[model samples]
Target: MKARVTVMLKNGVLDPQGEAVRHALGALGFDGVEGVRQGKVIELDLVQGTSQATVKEMCDKLLANAVIESYTIEMA
Candidate 1:
């Protein structure tokens, strides 16, 4: 099985890197770009029958920083 994890900043969080990207894009004439919030997508290969609870544990333990970010895991 494979688990895909997406980690992102929560709403109302400040993202200076994202702001930089947005500003650069606008300078490049990509004016339609409004906002950009940087995030990460991670894929993990796991043994079959890996539980959602276990995945969440992994996120809590290592994959995500709960103080600044949130994560969602999808299994395939």
Candidate 2:
């Protein structure tokens, strides 16, 4: 089995890295680039019987910062 986690910053939090990318895009002649937000994807190889509950617990403990970020999980 495999799993994926997508983690992103919550709205209203400043994303300096994303902002920098946006600025660079404009400087490189990419016009009308209004905004940019950055996020991460984590791919996991798991045992066949690993439960969604366990995955959620993993996110709560380590994968995401609950105070400022959110995460979604997909299993395959």
Candidate 3:
């Protein structure tokens, strides 16, 4: 099985890195860029029977920070 996790800041959270990217884009003449948000993707290879519940537990415990971030999981 394969699992993918996307981790990102919550809507109201601040993103300094994203802001930096937006600013740089504007400086480079990309004025149409208004907002930017950054996130990370994690890919995992699991055993055949690994369950979504177990993967979710991984996210809850370490992959994401519940206070400031959220995550989505997909399995294949």
Candidate 4:
């Protein structure tokens, strides 16, 4: 079984790295680049029969910082 997680900062949060990327793109003449935000995708292979609840617990405990970020998990 596999789990894929997408983690990102919540809206209204500042993203310095994303801003840097946007500025770099503009400098390179990549027009119409208005906004950009950065996030992370994590993939994990776990033993079969792992519960969604456990995965969620993992996210709450280590994968995400609930104060400033959100995460979604998809299982296969």
Q: lDDT of each model, Cα atoms only?
A: 0.94, 0.95, 0.95, 0.93
In candidate 2, the residue pairs with backbone N, CA or C atoms under 3 Å apart (3 or more residues apart, or in different chains) clash, namely none
How many backbone collisions does model 1 have? Answer: 0
Tens digits of per-residue lDDT for model 2, 1-76:
9989999999999999999999999999999999999999999999999988899999999999999999999988
Off by over 4 Å in 4: none
State the lDDT at 36 in candidate 4.
91
Error of 1 at 17 (Å): 1.5
lDDT of 3 at 4: 99
Q: Looking at model 2, how many pairs of residues clash?
A: 0
lDDT measured at residue 76 in model 4 versus the true structure, 0 to 100: 90
lDDT for position 69 in model 4: 91
Report the C-alpha lDDT of model 4 over 1-76, residue by residue, as the tens digit: 9999899999999988889999999999999999999988889899999988889999999999999999999999
Question: What ranges in model 2 sit over 4 Å off?
Answer: none
In lDDT terms, how accurate is model 1?
A: 0.94
TM values, all candidates: 0.94, 0.95, 0.94, 0.95
